[model samples]
Target: MTIRIGKIGYLNVLPIYHPLETGEIANDFSIVSGPPSALNQLMDAGRLDVSAASSIEYARHPDKYLLLPDIAIGSRGPVQSVLLLSRGPVDSLHGETIVVSAQTHTSAALLRVLLAEWKIRTNFVTGDATAILSRGERPQAILCIGDEALNLRFHPDYPVRTDLGEAWRTLTGMPFIFGVWIARRDSLDRSGQAVRRACDTLIRAKVWGQTNIASMCALAAERSCLSREELRSYFDGLVYDLGEAEKQGMTRFYRHLAEHGIIEDVPSLNFLA
Candidate 1:
């Protein structure tokens, strides 16, 4: 059986997918690339059998998916690719407006949660974040993630930017899981063994990539036009696996989501072996 795999095409994940690029894994599968949100749509639509999706996607629709054990895009603190850029301090957000990136549901919801918990009553304006550079929008703060976050990094003009993961830690004292590799329940039922094997392969790839950071940085530099040093900095700050801390954080996050009406219900967090 052929499996359709959806991946996020970003520099931060280039290393984890090295096996696929080097043919260490089978090429019989269909591969499609998009931002995490689009990949989630593909999986929900049955267009993809498995995908590396926004972790919150699986949390949002748990019955429909199975998390591949031992793997994820997570960070203990300071994820360089997800940032909250503000014109002023977060405490001064009482009557300000914030713009949110249109690419992700999880980050946007998380932003709202953090803002609400912090008692920052700001009106959020959602739109294409990339356009913020081209259009002079009316926003005191902006929530940007993924490639957009990478773009906004080190801009001398944006002096008050905070990493969202870091912000979460300061607010809730927990790590954040951004994305996970998940198999559709129906697809897993049809090809369980292959799915397991693929998950193992990807997990191994993640480990191997971590061990060979220099080479992975080189690959990322060539592909994404990011410097090796910058890519390394990004990888160094993020965790590549799903461990106990992430599980607990995810549980807390799901409860918050359910309480705040972001998701309809909360489901048990179970991993596929």
Candidate 2:
């Protein structure tokens, strides 16, 4: 039987699954890829057995899922893939519009927290970029994530960019976790060892990808239509594995979620062995 695994199809996560994509893992697993929010929706609806969901999703539904330790899509500094493109500076954001993409859950919340702390009040609009850009005036900043963020770099139409992950770190002095793998607790109990093996496979794949980044970048370039050098830069600048800093950031994020009543309680950072 093939184990169904839903993964985020973004470049930041490319390195983590490089080994699996290259057939280095012997396990019988089917990889389905999608955006973080979509994957979380699938996991919530039981359409997927396991998925790399946004950490906020896992925190929201802690009893239903188990976090896979030592593995995540994180960035200690500038995460090129998750960015907020602004037309003007932060100080000028007041009263100006900020368009938020529908593909995000954590970044939106994080932005709100930062804006509150920084005392930068602005009208937050949730809609499509095309619709927002169609107006006579565009938002002061447009929040973009996943492939859209990467694609924005090539367009040069958006002049200013702010890496949301980096911004959070600048404000809070902590790393940011955007995504994590979570197994259904019921299914995990039935096949605990298999779940652990899959998690191990992901960890090993990440290490191998980091060690052999050139080859990984080659594969990514072919897939993304980006040059090897450009692709390599994306891999080089990202932080793939979850460490202590990310754990602290995740805790803080969960606390914020709890404060907003998005979640009833803060989930312990529990991971399957």
Candidate with maximal lDDT: 1
Tens digits of per-residue lDDT for model 1, 64-153: 998988788878889988888877788887888788877787888888778778877888777776676667654677788986788776
* Candidate 1 global TM-score: 0.93
For model 1, the local distance difference test gives 0.81
Could you tell me which residue pairs clash in candidate 1?
none
Candidate 2 residue spans exceeding 4 A from truth: 130-137, 154-157, 260-262
**C-alpha RMSD for every candidate:** 1.8, 2.4
Clash pairs of candidate 2?
none
Q: Candidate 1, residue 263: CA error in Å?
A: 2.0
Worst 10 residues of 1 by lDDT: 21-30
Q: Best TM-score goes to which candidate?
A: 1
Error of 1 at 189 (Å): 1.5
lDDT of candidate 2 over 1-273, digit per residue (tens): 356788787776777676687687555778988877788898998777677888889888888988887888878878787777887677678778788888788778777777777788888878766556656556668888877777764445567787887888888888888888788887787777777777777778778778888887887777786789988777776777778888898998888777767678989988776
Per-candidate TM equals 0.93, 0.90
